[model samples]
Target chain A: MSGYHIAIVGATGAVGSKMMEMLEEATFPIESVTLLASKRSAGKVKNFKGMELVIEETTPDSFEGIDIALFSAGGGISKQFAPEAVKRGAVVIDNTSAYRMDLNVPLVVPEVNEEALRTHQGIIANPNCSTIQMMVALEPIRKKYGLKRIIVSTYQAVSGAGISAIKEMEDQAQHMLNKEGYEANILPCSGDQKHFPIAFNALPQIDVFSDAGYTYEEWKMMNETKKIMADETIKVAATCVRIPVVSGHSESIYFEVEDELATVFGIQQELMIAPGVVLQDDPDTQTYPTPLTAVGKKETFVGRIRKDLDEDKGFHMWVVSDNLLKGAAWNSIQIAESLHKLDLVKI
Target chain B: MSGYHIAIVGATGAVGSKMMEMLEEATFPIESVTLLASKRSAGKVKNFKGMELVIEETTPDSFEGIDIALFSAGGGISKQFAPEAVKRGAVVIDNTSAYRMDLNVPLVVPEVNEEALRTHQGIIANPNCSTIQMMVALEPIRKKYGLKRIIVSTYQAVSGAGISAIKEMEDQAQHMLNKEGYEANILPCSGDQKHFPIAFNALPQIDVFSDAGYTYEEWKMMNETKKIMADETIKVAATCVRIPVVSGHSESIYFEVEDELATVFGIQQELMIAPGVVLQDDPDTQTYPTPLTAVGKKETFVGRIRKDLDEDKGFHMWVVSDNLLKGAAWNSIQIAESLHKLDLVKI
Candidate 1:
């Protein structure tokens, strides 16, 4: 088989830069790599496989010979350029919410629903960062014990917003520690009207508010899970919160199995060997995953598993993973690799 | 009515100091105030109501002539001294977990169950910090619509541990922002063998592990909610986590009410007039309570109330309050005020 051509849109952003690192780490066969970004970053030089590649402005002509194009740019960019890339015969894997809930586009998490890539109509959408890690953790349990309901509360990091939000949080923390005042201009949501400081604090709002008082982030979690799992009957509820962590996102999840006989031990047994999952639960040794411990990792970390004292089928667990890696960049690369393995895209 | 004599045990601790502040703010009639701590702090001076008081070593005889005693010491100190105060004819308001689950003692959050204070057997126990805010937020809805289940995930502050933990978190944050090394000596649980950093991170373990792999703090939230609400049939599950915030504790609570007709507006109406609850739910303006906004306040701030997208009776909300104020000292003072109003304590 001959090597294929790859193009990365938004090459200078947080998740886009991580995609470059993840692609190199995956060692996928590639003939050439094209780095594309906004006009301001067009001439920036980036290294791939020991060769310097100059980033070019992402015009409609940038997808001429590309087999796979990864999009981590803003949703507006994806909305404008994703179809253009597809019209030029490139399979676009978008990491934005622009195409996720489309009726024709398949929202894919490679570990959970790689086969959904087969039905994709030229644009495969990456699930929300919060939803991607959760799908990875819950799919194994759902397969073994027939899932019913999920209630999740997220402890997400500042980096999920962008690179500027991390700088804002650090600057605010320095001012807070020194007993001075700092401005909050980049967080909760950068595009929203109001901004709140994320230093040594927790904000319950993630994205903008959607219908029924749920944020867009929370709505995405609820809707995307049902679509990706291909089970419209599975119930999901989420409260998305941003904490002061820099990289990892943690979730406290409560789930009820359809089978009443499922125990904590049985669920743990299934996750122990599940793909792309790391089980770190041990009560005796005080072992569990924290945001500090899970940063920069590719696998989702699950721990603190316990059965509900009242409901026989209910259980609780903590899931953590690096948001930029497993939640965004690495997942997108995995989808690209899946398309390669399935021969869905021409090389 | 003549003023009564009062004594504060562990007067040098975190909650104890807040108790002093709350007492002054409440303008409760007091003839005399006595401060008591361990032998190491015996010579310290604390001012209450413009009157200087000397800290004495807490002995069994310290309760003599005291009409009420407030205990904020460790569980061991409460266990050894609470009984002595009760035997000496002083009604004790304990902020420790020593007597909270005892069948003889009544665990109280005044907003939810001030009537429970009338049956106190000379000792009224203050509920856990994370549990108190949740009860205040949910008990209003529970009174109108019967509550069936509760699943809570807490984003608690370091001040819940003690003043020293707050210092450790600050030092660690300074080191972390400077890209240097720091130590984790007093977090997650100081009594537990292991310690993890809380700066820019999230720790899933709050207190030590208990039966069935639940932490003692999580267990407290589960058991205390049942005892205070006096409903053993209601199911409860909690995931207690510690974040780097200095004072307030935040919780993402999911609850199921028995009435299928209950709407988000119905629950908001209950909280609007509920005692010690502030409603901040406004999605258009992006209004909600955060840890920094709730610090040093006596009321429990609730917002982001939404009904479950799938279940007819399920709902989700965010609850926040000062862990030292409403969660501990303010709640303790409210219980004392309840005792005075009910004529349960002698002057």
Candidate 2:
């Protein structure tokens, strides 16, 4: 092949479609593309550029000629097919939490840890949606001032839960607005015992709760940030909340910097020129980032930067990005591009 | 003529009307009632206990027969007429931010600082809505374990702003859903120079920016928590956000208690017996307090109780309450009930 043959697992899914859409925009050399999904969704057809690609049932044979595989299916699919793809010489970039904390697999958010791509042994991991955007926004600041502790409270979009959750939000909102009743089953996590209404309401539990009372989604954020940033001593806490919005995930972040001299202006000036970050703070003009405004595009938007009123080393800022884009699909594509840029993948 | 005559300043306002409704449910002796508002709102007839009372344009003479006045008018109105009402022999329970911080005035959350009401000099100040709910939820725990520090992120409702802000949110949401544009003018504090949309989005700034880039609303939370809790050395920080919700305010609170052995169960036990607080922390059933579920409730709802993974003395909770009821009107009424109970209101 003249260029890399890429295979997209979970082709009919939200993030998979987004991956194809983002691939068209990025100038990466893709010789061919394959779409794969479960047997139930196998016959589905999706469009990439002007071509119609039919989704084939994902199997061990699905990655024979693929150089790079992007997997966004459920954890079971990734656990089953990712290693199979790796066995056939295709480097699998997983979008689930299946291998993120795996010591062997390099967890990468291209803007934060591109160098990690070089050590990947046939498989690499894209971080959790919330963690990826946060990593992109905080990486530069961490590099300059050094991070002491991070406390984040997220206002996440329903789209991060999947397409059904999005529909659930819209349908529930309409039902609630009309003073009717609708059963909420897919949200808060379909696998979880109870489902709460997300239309015009916020749910504190993002994924299944762990033994420690933190949701798995929250645990992912706490651990993944540390692994991706290559720091163990740094303390991270997250309170993940799901709001009615469909695409963007917004975070209220409070972090203490090791360097006491790091001013809000200094952080802003650095973020202004930093990669994958867009600074949108202007209190005078009432300018700040919101989920509705951050629906599309790649960069993480940050604003409402202020030094904490009590703590001299503490600073707070608002960080937001399209959860489906920079948070997931775009980040995977960026990792694929990074593999190429760093000469880590021989296509 | 027999019982204390109650007058409602800003009787046409959201909180003022809520005060009237709360008064209907609370067991308080009212011999007669007077409704007062601005000149523009004067002559507006509102029903109270099946009696239609015409709103009178507020003047010093309006307080002649008024033994107790509940002031929910804007700070400017309260600043102008509250002293006049007090001078005319009415105990003014002000809901504006004007007198809450006045050392001479009692900033009471009722549950946390009801004793402060005994120190009032005619005007007993109601703590901010967001602060009131947190105080109600935390006071029980603070009594058992003692509190060291608190960090909070709020999901505040539009009704806290005013009637116009609620209408603006509804109008803007419908317009945006219909794919039309609407101008946002009365949220994040109407007195602020600019305003932003609170429909399907989050605005980090709640009130106007004070020095150090913290909003006045944020400052109110930080300072009011200490003032109402009557502890000057306890550290408190707040990042207040406005959401599209109509009535209740939700806060994600992280606090450090003085006792290191404080278990989530112990905290929950304290809250279970606590007055004006409801503990709903069953994560298995996805039972948590959201704004929608908290509307029109007088008691503060607390849930999502968990011990912090890193800090031994730290714990996380979600606190929600109707900003109009327990936050504003109900708190004001509770204070009135307190004054009456304490024999401080002898008309």
Off by over 4 Å in 1: none
Worst 10 residues of 2 chain B by lDDT: B170-179
**Model 1 per-residue lDDT tens digits across residues B153-209:** 999999999999999999999999999999999888998999999999999998899
Error of 2 at A277 (Å): 0.8
lDDT of 1 at B173: 93
lDDT against the true structure, each candidate: 0.93, 0.88
Query: Candidate 2's chain A scores what TM-score?
Result: 0.99
Candidate 1 chain A: 10-residue stretch with minimal lDDT? A24-33
For every candidate structure, what is the RMSD over all alpha carbons to the true structure, in angstroms? 1.1, 1.6
DockQ of 2: 0.65
Error of 2 at B305 (Å): 1.5
* lDDT (tens digit, per residue) of candidate 2 on B100-217: 8899998997778788777778998888999899999988999999999888999888888899987787778677666788888887678778777787788888888876777889
Least lDDT summed over 10 consecutive residues: which range in candidate 2 chain A?
Answer: A170-179
TM-score, A chain, model 1: 0.99
TM-score of each: 0.99, 0.97
Pull out the clashing pairs in model 2.
none
